[model samples]
Target: MAKARSAIVSSGPVGFLPVSITFFMAILMLLPIGSGASNIIMPHLVMISIFYWLSSRPLLMPYGACAVLGLCIDLWLNVPLGLNMLLLLLTRLFVLNQLKHYKGRNRAVHWGVFAVMSCGLYLISWILFSAIHSEFWPIKPVLMQWLVTAFSYAPVAFLLGRLRRWAW
Candidate 1:
């Protein structure tokens, strides 16, 4: 029992990378990019971080940590409560379920998969917001955000892969 407890305690340091990186990304998203359209079209840094960690190191990120980070993002961004939390949780689940197939795949494959998933995520967000407001939200901004997010995945994933190596 003592050995088991120690083993669990030892995993905490390893787990710190995903949580810290995701939290840092979420905080960074709060920074002002620019005044009008630029801000609306900015990539979802936290979402990218979450997906990267979920794909590459699901054990490190874990569902609970993702939930907390998502909630933090929702509160900080002042969007509808639980919006990000649901999205992150769903993203994590999808990535985890598909991880077996992704193993041994090249970076290009990963990027392609991320692009599709990110688009779906943005679409879902648009639907949710429309439902909440009882009217259809303009999708141009969502499309722009999705495009930026999809294009940004490769570079962000590369950086995150480096971070994972350093952490390990």
Candidate 2:
């Protein structure tokens, strides 16, 4: 009988490209784009990176890396610890589960999946924030962030695709 493949065994060896690119995206996201209020609409560059790499190159962007990146984001954003960790982890899981269905599909279909995933994740963030504060947080900002992030995915993916190609 063929030996069953475990998670670590199935994934290819980790490398510098994925880690560096993801962290670069994270730093870009953490930068001050504008005034404090404007930051609310800042696209989630790091999340987009995570989603792209997880889908396009799952072996390179493992769950442990996702967790670490999320923790770093949580620290940078000053939100409750583990919030981003949870988000990124969920993104990893969701993308991996749906990989076979969407792999090699049309770009538009990938974008649609990303849109839906971002919407759900943002909604969960809003709900979690409200629960933490014991009140409903204004969801307009959350919605705006989601809109920006969803719209930004295509270009970000394009750039990362180039980087991925270059690295190999």
By TM-score, the best candidate is 1
lDDT digits (tens) for residues 1-168 of candidate 2 = 233433333444435567778898889887676775654466888889888888876877888899999999999889999999999999999999998999999888899999999999999999998999999999988998999999999999999888777755
The residue pairs in collision within model 1 are none
- Model 1 quality (TM-score): 0.89
| Residue pairs with backbone atoms closer than 3 Å in model 2 (clashes) | none
Model 1: ten consecutive residues of lowest lDDT? 33-42
User: Which numbered prediction scores highest in lDDT against the true structure?
Assistant: 2
| Shift of residue 22 alpha carbon in model 1, Å | 0.7
Q: Estimate each model's TM-score.
A: 0.89, 0.88
lDDT of model number 2:
0.85
Residue 112 lDDT (model 1):
86
